[model samples]
Target: MNEMINRRKLLQAGGALIVTFSLPMARAATPAAEKTLSPARVDGFLAVAHDGTVTVYSGKVDLGTGVRTALTQIVADELDVPMNQVTIIEGDTALTPDQGTTSGSFSIQNGGMQLRRAAATARRALLRRAAAQMDRDISTLLIRNGVVTAAGGEGLPIGSLVEPTALALDIEKDAPQKAPGDYTVVGKPVRRLDIPDKVDGRFTFMQDFTVPGMLHGRVVRPSGFGATLVSYDESSIADIPGIVKIVRISNFLGVLAKSEWSAIKAAEQLKVTWSSWSDLPDQSKIWEHVRNTPVVHDDVTSRLGSSRAVLGAAPRKLRSTYDFAIHTHGSIGPSCAVATFTDGKLTCWTASQATHDLRKQLAAMLALSDADVRCVYVEGAGCYGRNGHEDAAADAALLARAAGTPVRVQWMRADEHGWDPKGPPTLLDMRAGVDPQGNLAAWESELFVPDGSATFVPLTGAELAGLNSLGKLSPGGVLNDLSIPYDIPNVTTTAHRLQSTPLRPAWIRSPGRLQNTFANESFLDEIAASIGADPLDIRLQHLEDARGKELLERLAKLSKWRERREPDRNAEVVTGRGLAYVKYELVRTYVGAVADVEINRKTGALAVKRFYVAHDCGQIINPDGLRNQIEGCVVQTVSRILKEEVTFDRSMVTSLDWASYPILTFPEIPEIVIDLIDRPQEVPWGGGEPTCAVVPSAIAGAVFEATGVRLRSVPFTPRKVLAVLRAS
Candidate 1:
């Protein structure tokens, strides 16, 4: 297909419409060929057609987070237009601007605001046109649902006032935006735009997308980490009916076939020898490795009084070390991508969250200019953070270039589990001192984490090919929430960035905030248990932020929290309630959670019976969408805290399937209650990740209350629980 036809096809497939318009309404229509979208211009974000349909272009994509609908709401409300008239196209390197990656829950907080401002600028420009056309004062014209009405009852549709071309207008920073009190759609519980098609399987995912004359490709990975391909016998796959070619660059080996099944068969049948290296540490001793690894530098995130001196002199002191295991994204459907190389230009259809960045990386890999590479986003399996999608795209680009044809690369389950970037292991040492009146006088924490340089997260296929890969590290955010949020008199927090880590690391959901909050909140609960105080009450005493205090108080009422009484350790089964709170990253969203857990002392099985959450994310865009995000956070994080861990031997990951790295099953999910505090007057934060930061700590507190054994480590496995019980 030609470029224009391809652009139209992409928009239609993504459930968006292509529209064009220019500013001032009276300007002559520019030739469609000459029109270009620029991020700095209002036209880049919004377009209007003769039919009055509004098409929005956003760089932030919706990875099943419902931002597609939430962003539409922001634009619809700001422009005084009906939601049905708005359509959003996202994450297309050629169409959308570079709004950065869609991680850290910034889609709504940052990206949404950009769209809102653009819409407001468009509205102002349109109103001026209407006033001039009707010979009326600007203040006398009112717009509602794309119709401008004057005081004399004369009205005009917005379509009649605009040219059918690019807006070509610069965005006005001080454009007047509709007051929140006047919003008719933004805060309402509107249904998500992409949900129905997804539910009925009508939506086209990246795996299902294809270009004409596409060959199926599968990469052959080594059996263990740090292994290099010595040689491959391609003749072994000659009998495979549809086997076309085998492409190998250095250690990167891949098979292309007429069909996907043939590619898979050929890949499995190809005989290959590889060089092995034992560089990974033992999984059991990973925490020890983290502690012993040389520190690149210690970052003092927060400091108050002299914590070391106060802790040394304090009458009562508590010290404990907590560690979180490595975790994979474990996307239900493995990553998939399609790439084509034509006329020395590359176009890739992928599911990467950062398409613009992927385009840059691919351009660099192929030694092409950025203008020659285009990355288009098609929704795939939900990956909360950076995963294998980008690597899969890289694989397709390489094979497509070699075969001189379009190639579709679909990662096998093993490829996904074995090679996807992992959430790096985190080890934390926490110390606190209690004052004479049972108040916390001092708090100190030291975090052992890897260098979270996202730019260095290497592409597996590129690295194997011996190309210019960024590096081996895939570290995620590791310094967020390093310091406790409570009002401790003497407090200090330090993060020791390790020069190296055992596995490829990448951000997963809440990233560093989740692990750091787990240690901080759980340690606070441990102190409360030691001093015979209610967990919720203790948090309330130290929390100085009004929003945080209100959130915790609301959580107590929601969960019907009661003071913890001494548990009967001799009982065969017991139940207890525990609380945790976090001001996400110590600045953004505020969340408080309470978990009710049931434990079988005999088998050491732990089940969360119920969970309650109180969330304050400043403003509400779509109540239903926000609730959905919060609920998803609670369920997924419960799995992480109770079962999810990337199991590995000395060389490579051993857990390659669901049977090995199990997740929280539907039957295991607990009943969840959520209360959202919406402040329309406040700026909207994010709903995607704040609630996740509290799940682990709340569950840990509940486990401690039930068994009176503080479970500092994550994924409190049955063996670990039983061992602690037997020793006690």
Candidate 2:
């Protein structure tokens, strides 16, 4: 896990850059092989018409993340064109390269970097042509405002120089990049391009999208996992106005209508009798369910020296268990997609994060080639991870392919909650021992979770429908962030994947890494308390990385270190501060957070008053974007810790509406402050998900500091807090 970036795919054509990697395997792979993998594609094309309007095409779409503006700024600055001249087209698979999904927070680091280098290469090609035409050396000329200049002798407009001939074809992997100080657009915070439309209500999300002759449709989902449709009476809805058709294959049932309300009303009246299944696990005993399952794979993720030997010689010891419950994405509205099947081709406009993957999966489902189907990304609800957006797309395609017409399918909110893939429940056991000096020891952790390969979270819609599935799983993240960064003598981390479970897990936000971080950081704080040491001080002592130390030290200052205090055993309302640190995937996105809380003694209610974070994600593409990502992480994580959980009965999911499943309210949000460390020389890293991994532990520490108690689980509700207090 070394620093991987600052990459350029070296080209013999004109020295254009692609992606830089620190992995030897990636480096050893040939250019053709790399293309076969996650190709660093420059799908963007610069078209300069006679009027000098520059249009750029990108494979990566903007998910309200302001990437359109950032990528536009990169191209404008690098190509020496006016910002106003650039228009970006994204997420149209037919016209763009396969840049893969916009997940993992790598859009800017991977997508924007390639676009920047591509524009730079285009500029170089323009200069080469200019140099040839003017009979002058390339270095002697300067470019400004999309025009090549030479000693005030001649000014050649880019529009005149482009096509009949294309400059991009001759451009390769290497090009002159602007130095940090010379950057005018890359580092600054520009206004987002998509915000104005959203504010004015002109923006159309998938829920509101309409096409000529498009029919509205709805699906009747199963009551529970393994449920089958026994019978359905379509004649019951025949009286409904504009009811076009009812399509059902196996358990999948859909109703299509000429009008939206007609479709919904008809579907509601179309009675579907579904057979139930009694095999689902009880929600109350999720931890037990996960632990009791047979192991599909059990292996130590990382080990250094023998932890058993070192801990056996220690003078003191402590052990703790942390459990995480199933949760949902909780989007503002139900998932929706629009699909058109015409002339043997299927086209879908969806909000899926992975369009290429969606296209491939849909093609496979329909028994068609990739060319016969296209998935175009459209703005939907802000999907944090694998939500039901893609599933809705599949529903639309399934119906549209059958109806042979344009169809828009939208799942009801209850249907969404009932079947959406959930974040897997986990039980983590941590054991460690402190030496005589209370400064050194051995550490070990065991993660009891769903089978690594069998339960590997699904990424596509086919997996959710149970018709098609991704066969294998990646080895990493089974116990990511479990490896201790502390300078310890012995440490061991093992992961046990459950052989089978009813739950279908998907990558929700940070996935298993966030759960693992919550456990490890909270347990570390517990260890500090047992050893009679301050949490911040203990971290500073063991963390040898300067970046980690810098984050902690900065957060400590921002949070006002002098104000934190020891836990008070007898206070009407307890108030205190606590700290936590994390590195995403163990080597990327270093983050530290300090949280302050006020806890009510009688009711055991907790309110986080403030949270401060220090982040080091290498280079700064957009300072405001980084701050927004950190702030979003803090708010969403606090919501997860305090109120959100997926609840289900033994045979069915009961948390089907907002009343059953809750999220953070506007009034409950706390003040979040962010500090960023920028190293422009290093490769830019992602700031999307990892910033959240530090939040739960920091909040837990703050609660413990306010009261003479410890929190091992999330959503430290009044009932749970009271139970812990009574037992203590």
Candidate 3:
């Protein structure tokens, strides 16, 4: 390995970038040659080794999205090999060139496309080579089971023709991808390749990775944001049993021991002093702060006409404010990282989404070259953008480098819950003017928040300064709601960035789309109600595009929503229906409306009996995987809407564990019916996030329909619901 420089900086072309790099040869070949080859693969290799095993390397991570199965199918389809012949290697920094991270629902949308194209090109190259070797026409060479047969029954398996070194094949940069009509395996509902191990408990997540002679480590993260370690007494920990060493490296304090339990226990026993925040900042104050922040661009850069004039002159208008709370990814397994340093090189195994970035960060922290750091994948815990596997992995590497031994660090549930950076609290203030005839004359919304993608971690001193001053700039969030698909005469939305206590945010599943969609969809519901309109009908009235229509059509058909009776008819409970839809990136779009929710009038208990969602994300890779992703989104969103929050007093997190920051258990999980629109020809979109955008709104809307009371904030806990009911 060569010394590693910051390869990331070299790749960034600036401004919300998406990059794709192809190996030279077939994939990047000229258009004339690219078309001459077989068309089953796109961006990856499908080859027979000397031993006759078929290997496929993918640029996308499984991330539990079934990219492994999807990519394998492409290879199997293109190479005319059985599924059993293929072996998939994914998200390893050492072996694979840098594909982008796995976030943004781009795994199959972008990465799958690349792999499919590459595999197709390789299959063609091999067949071309086979024809030459056999002195036969390429068209007549039949490829099946890794063998090529001639018209006269002369045949040879691909493995027989292998050179000492494997022939390298590249993908065409602009090769016309195999369309859905030509797809042999992509759009089908194939079983997952990673499922067997997962079901049999044979899979190894990062937490499961272990090394010979590796010591366990735990870092004493400050208990609060902005809390610095002024001093610590390690004297007490030094005498603890199994303690290997206590070390302070630059800014972090760590304890290394023979076992994870011993290290954690010893570290907990040591008393440390931390600088706490001077004041208490609760949910209300944070929401208020967000609401009061100035709007960045008043005109809101819209194609609509003069919203200001229409809103100001309108005879009657409705305006309201909505709040969203913080939530964690709450992955099934906790976060852990294992790293070893030897010969001035570090090797780490983790299930992180961003391998290239992880390698860079580890290298920089250890003062090593990018080549000196290698990141490989273990099965990962769930990552909702909150999974800090990269941070934990880097921490382990830094600790291992300092202690002169390999280290595995596992974050306890409390440590994971309390210390992980959260999705920022958001505030939306929307005001709309509707004409007497129920036409939306004007609409305006002001959104406030800091940049979610500003830094990998929350801002420190210098980073904080830069972020606060740049708060006037765009904070990089989704804005689908602001742009009404309806041909409204006047509509404008403005976003203002407010520097919050130097906190860093990243792309959670839906990030900007979640809060913005909640506000927009909920407000649209309110507008529909104010006009005495059916929520679905009103939405249909406004939807002008084909994608929007397709989503609505699918949603209506799957939910059987149109034939259902009125929400108020279920007098036993407050039952109502609500709808939400969004276009997340150009690759995929979805529209979903939920039904069946009840709020107990007496005890303030809430029961989401069932939810029906319809999604249209172009091609379906795995029906089961898509369904699982949507269901996971539903469960995750329920946690956010019902009971999960990170509270702070004096900048110190008070809800510190699973007990305090609750996740949705099986008991609380509602029945979710997911329907995928089978438009395989359309661009494939992400399913994980689109459903999340509208969950809170659907719940809130259902509660409103049931009880005529509204939930103005997230985590519509019992107390908030009771308070609203009592007031009503």
Candidate 4:
């Protein structure tokens, strides 16, 4: 069977309707050779059928962020169709345009806008056809519920205008879009499309997907990083039932079996010898290592007046150092993928956020043309950033090619927690000066961070197999918000890009903004405490952006923020509220947060009681979905700040299970209240990561208020808290 035809059949079998453009329509275009995946083409994004149902093709997959429904809302509103009449297909290399990775919360901001333009173009074309067919002026026709009607009540279904053909027109750069005030669906709190299937256990996650005659496979990783496989004894797993094949290429090793359990047993029982490597620095002194690492180059992100001169002339100056611990994606489910190679073409079903990029990587690893590889997206574990999904896809592809059959690879828990690329540790040094009148004078900050972003994180299986991979280290884009958002007399910020880090680095949500904002906002609070000023008041005084100031004020009103006074040192248990704000990336979304916390002086135990957030991302697509993202961001960031950390020795990671690396529990969740500010006339920004940037700083500020001890490091365990308390 033809691979493209086979893929369509598979999609149809999975309950999705696949519509193809007619030959006549394809031939009607000015350029007959125009690519089907062209982002500028209307047919690439939208397909209309005789039954009036519309199909939308998008390259950006939803990573459990509810973007699937949100994108649908954008299309429905712009195309004047019922939301239910539209269905979307996402992240198929052969089916959807390459909209790049679904990271940085750009799915709606970038990809949805592209689709919206395409939909608008299609709507315009359809309206023209309807006008010609009904002998009415185009301006006198209105589309409602996918039906074009004239002022005389004569109407035609949208499907009738484009039956047996495609919308072969190019997308108009200035296509007409529905006004915000006229929208009836885009901003509404429509229920998520994936929720019902997920709740009822009917959603087909990547782990549940399968191909005919597929074998179960599992990769065997080396004992530690940089370890080289010397030998493996296949006879060791001879007694294992259903063993199919043992694939060993260079340092890469894996086992295939007739069943999933058989693959697991065979992989675990197989004997392998490997050379050892212990180059990682001690975790206890990771901060020192980060500070001392050789600098590749200095990125002067922001510089205003002469900070050195102002600080020298100021009366009082304060300095503080802060660090964030390494973290894992901690996906609830392990990564999984299924792959098959037939007639020199490989097809893979994966949950990778960047399927198009994965397709290229897999093709390079296999030494095949890009056109010969196809990557299909299936919902799987929610990886907020790059995790093991792409690696698992590579593993499945390699094993499938070797075994001469379809193969499914599922990563074990240990594999996920121990081997997945980590969110690298971050260190920042902050300095601020206050004038004689107790006003801010100067501010300076320097960040010691990894040299690259997630774009450089290599494919694990390819790297292990001695195939093509980007041999560079990255901790995502942490350079964001290195420059503070506050308006000050003299300000300077620089990031010292480190040549090496303690572990293989990848992006884990908000990336650099989360870490930098933690330092920026918390240090602002430290300055406030030093000068006996209210945290909220100090932020408001320094902020100049109208939107940022409004967000802070709204946060105060929502949280019922009160001015702080001197702490009672004699109290046994103390309660305090702290404030933090961020203009994410210093330009995009704006967020303000308040954290209420309680602490026990005796045990040095801190408990967050509540969180109040004020968020403004310009325009709102789905208010309910935006709220869910903010709630999840708060919960997860709380986990990252209070509990999560990846432990490692010189040779390998030691935190391989939940007990070793704890996350926040359900019982520990705090009451969360959010006030969303909608600016309908302005362009929509990202909602996924903006709110997370404030979480750590807010919690840190709250911890400081509850106890006069500042938490300069993350994962504030009781031991660290107690040690700081005793030292204070």
Candidate 5:
């Protein structure tokens, strides 16, 4: 394995390639070789060897978050070295420490701090050693540009002292931590290190990974859920020239071929029959069953107030049922994995957010120790929590073990969309009780389809125990309002588990919060309209405390919510404004949106012209990245709200591709204005999921302002709008 490139060697007949090495000037008394060094090079006083090349490891990934640049700035600020000298390796299990996943928008909060502390510790050690050698106080020794110098003159570069010496220190438990005053770097935006490589097309993603003797693999999956591959007649593909071997496992059947194209071509030639349970149901029937289930995890799930009493005692109450159909992530790139098992060692290259979990799952499935399995992170095209790299990696490993060779399994875009674990269709029945004074008194909701509290994915004993003890199954955090951020006198929200197909329903951006907020916020807007109170004033009346107030204040200012007006433009076009609020964990984010829709009074074509969004996710890591995420969310939400839906004909999805299940294109994308407010960095909050929670509700509320009709169903397509208008 070459540590410089951070790639596993194929292990064939290849002569030794002359590797280049750069040695830094080492100071005396300090040993040259310290393998325990945690790539925590902040002051540039230390360097580690990776296949003879000096490299620096930063605990951040270029998950397109630009954390690599931010991390290098921290190193450059302390080390007094140029940015070019820093060669960063990211998210590699073999070369880098387990810095955890790059989701949750917490890379800088957690990973960035660890790297900074490590660097500070290393710098302190080097200066202390220099002071001991110079016979001066450790405080007098200042390090600048990879060298230690006395207060007056005469200095030595720390790199000059290179030997086998133990330089072990603990920076993990130091209290009080580093103050903001000591930070000369970290906060400043640094140039991204991955830009040049990406521009040059040299960055190696999972799609770019290729081995010298690797074979392409394709798995034959069951057509529907609970279906098993009864048998496969490979005799039909006997004439296919490049087809090499066929391996069948307990889960899936795989066919290996010489080329990726060839493997896919040969897979169609094989005859396969699948057998499913007799009582196979369709999407409509499945949703109907879900909407009528009883709440089981009430005590542990939702905690607002008693719904039965609130609904019965209220003088004025509004009750409506909202339905969200199943939708796939539809990531631009399909799921891919390449696994090689040779000489009792296993290495998997894939795009995964959960690397440690993937490694542990694969190791247990292969009956191998944790050390035998390694996962190499790759570039992800689009990961809205739908890249099931673990399944892909395990599938590849299973095929490789059967063939005794490395295999790369790649799913086609259609196959990925058809089999992708959807975000799970939800049925939300919400009831609100409002007093004559227009103040909210009671609120209640019944969440159908299991509340997404757990998943059925295969896991090891340790992983299962952790999930069980913590009670955090897949989308378990769906109870975003378990604490109830509003000041309603009495509130009750309970989750009911219903029997759906065995599809792994995980978090998709905001997940449960988005669905819940859309229902809650839109209904709140309706209640405000009914009471003749300003939407902004109504929200201000009950914003919990100070943090919620800050969000509402900033968002209202951005959208000018005080001067509200109903759409009275041309008869064919109308415009309106809407607001939504979301509080996930301890972070509070509010969004105010204004939308313009062009309606053809004759044709009934409703085209969204523009959407304005304002968000407050506290401290911003990269302002550009933050704004882009919010704008992207707006576009995706509009698309989903308008044309995205998985239509069902029988038991299978009919709208499987772009032709049927349409996404927003260039023409459909409206002008989006994103304003971010600086809440506070006292503790870094999340930006990724918070911004996503507002869009669906904003669009829904905006449409009501435009059409004077309530849309209770998702994917308010043009035809659906036409139907509503015609029925009126």
Candidate 6:
């Protein structure tokens, strides 16, 4: 591969074709080279090389979720090839087709499903060729592990069949696939191919990549989110070694140097003053501010019959309020990106989840056509939802444009938490009514939130461009519309997306569902307690779906529901068991969780000793990978509920480091037991985010059961726990 793309290669490839040489030799293809070898239609998202090697193109990038392994397994089985024969390519705009963002656990559900069908189609096309060559019927031939055999025992490898002739034919037609029971590779636990590279420090994360002659950049953030740059002294940093240039766009100031340490030193020395704004509301009164803020009511989000009349005429009624504050992504390593601009075109290597959309945004910012700008995906540190990755990419692009050289920009840890959009605060008031039969007759919910926590480009990209495009938010994250899988007579859920605060908000994992489920499930337990019925019996009695019931029942058995319910009553620590259930989207990924807790009365500390999670996300892809996703979700969500919160005053975010915003430590981590529901016949749902919503609810329920205290807020810190205990 030609690793360098200077003036010589720039002129050779011309400006019309995208020039990218980052991929290794096994996957590289120049514009001219691809034109000759490219097929009219993909053999279901796969290509065969002259060397008999196969490469799979996927639009989804792996964020340590193991999509590469699962997608490869699907394609390998359909193509009848061994794992070693398959090479997976992902998130390369110049190479792979667009599959939107790699979020909401849609990679496996949408991209994996599409590839599964594509591989099947490619196999049928190859079989058709074999039938013609052998002069035998296609049905009579057999293929296994990429080798086809005829009735007379004649055999041929599939690599020889994929030629220029096959390239001329479109092979995307629907083809027959093996039944679930006949699958040889799709359902098994396959080790992650990307892990060995990551384990040995060979993986090229976004922060690790270095383009030839690339400059290092470090951005200096302002006092707060809404502050504006007034004046800056450039010569103050002239004494720093290797001070290449100082790029400034309004409040977006950065220092570039030969090395990252030099850039950091220069950035620290350069003093930039910013204008302050009082548009920010009081952070202490955020709960009241959100509740009283002007909000547009959404009546059509979720509704059944007349809930008002049903609840008014019910035999019993209960209501409670739950609040979730804004939280930061708290990535261990801050986000980084590299960009270069030349010949009226720009290219960027980013860790953004939305590459295709990012390309459009960059094109719009630079006044170029979408085709002139290319955004290649590079894996980075943890990003639950719209972190500082995109903003860092924008920063690199601005610096590169000013310097006319490839510049790598990396945000300091403080800049990441201080400026990165946060997961918005949510306030929910849940009301429920029950009949004499102990079944829910009416359920009404009111959820109040800021302009939703979904992806807000203006929040990050527009801010980098000095444009405040914060009038309204996206529709993805304001999931105030909460419903239950259990049967109900009259149900109504209303979502109020209020005007946003000065702090811009974006998506983080499950978003409103986590807070909403905590409120809904806790309220359900309150109703059960009012009637003196076991929470399990109430849930089982109301559960109409057989799948939902099975999930809860299995979790109960795993947690030893009856034997350990009371926890011996006189243990060293207050012991209790509790359960929570939810179906993400009210239709996808049914989850039931049970938690066993031991609370220290004197210290007001809550320890979740063990957990049982029953998850049904349709068919299983990789059992180990699914377990990994669930385990991560459980741990991270517990951290959010117990120790994580983004605190800010009127001036700036005060909680800038790990000391101010501590997460659940290793000692706090509990033993997690997972039960995966594998139904290969059903289409697979998302595995990454659904299980997170119920974790908080289960833990809170157990805490309440242990001490007879109803805790509404999250991050059950000692202070908050003691306050509730004292009030009781």
Candidate 6: where is the Cα deviation over 4 Å? Answer: 1-44, 165-173, 436-438, 452-456, 459-461, 467-472, 567-572
Q: Scored by CA lDDT, what does every candidate get?
A: 0.85, 0.75, 0.68, 0.86, 0.62, 0.77
- Per-residue lDDT tens digits for candidate 2, residues 62-123, read 76667778778878888878888887756655545667577677777787777777777778
Model 3 Cα lDDT, one tens digit per residue, 130-244? 8999888898987777787889988888777765333454465654445567656667788887789889987766777776678999888766655667788878777678999
How does each model score on TM-score?
Answer: 0.96, 0.91, 0.88, 0.96, 0.85, 0.93
Q: lDDT by residue for model 6 over 1-728, one digit each (tens)?
A: 34444533432221212222223222211212342212235632567664446777677878778888999888888777888888876666656667778888889998887777767777787889888988889998877877888878888788777775563345454568767887788889988888898889888788787777789998887776677888899889888889898877766777889998999999888888878855667887888888788886554456788888989988888888988878888887798988888766787888888876677677766677776777777788777867878778878877888788889988887888787777877788888888777667888888887654433455354565565433236534557326666677788888777866546676778877788888888888888888887878888988888888998888888777766645543454798878999888777888889988888877788888888999999899899899989999998888998888888887778788889989888988889999899989998898899888998889888988898888788778888887888888
- Which is superior by TM-score, 4 or 6? 4
| Candidate 4 C-alpha lDDT tens digits along 302-412 | 988989999988899999999999999989899999888877778788999998888888888999988888788888867889898988999999999998888999999
Measured by lDDT, the strongest candidate is 4
Instruction: State residue 118's C-alpha deviation in candidate 6, in Å.
Output: 1.1
After superposition on all CA atoms, what RMSD does each candidate show versus the true structure?
A: 3.2, 8.1, 7.0, 3.0, 5.9, 3.7
Which scores greater on TM-score, model 1 or model 2? Answer: 1
lDDT tens readout by residue for model 5, 1-728: 44323221431111011121221112111111322325433322224222212245433465555666666655554444455655565554544566656666566667766665666666666666777778889878766656678888878676653222313455633523334444444444444566788899977667676766679998776665446667888897888778889877654678899888879977777898887633444555756656555544543354556656866877899888887766777776777888877666677776776665576677767778777776766766667663455557777777777777779988776656666556777777788887766567887877775544543344312131122211123653555643346777777776666544324466666667777777777778777777777767787787776767776777667667666666763466566566676676545445555555555545656667777666665554456655656777777777777777765544344566788778888898888776667543454455556666667667767667766766667777777767776776
- Write down the lDDT that model 3 would get: 0.68
Between candidates 3 and 6, name the one with more favorable lDDT: 6
Error of 3 at 141 (Å): 3.5
Residue 158's lDDT within candidate 6 is 82
Please tell me which model should have the higher TM-score, number 3 or number 6.
Answer: 6
- Candidate 6: deviation at residue 203, Å? 2.0
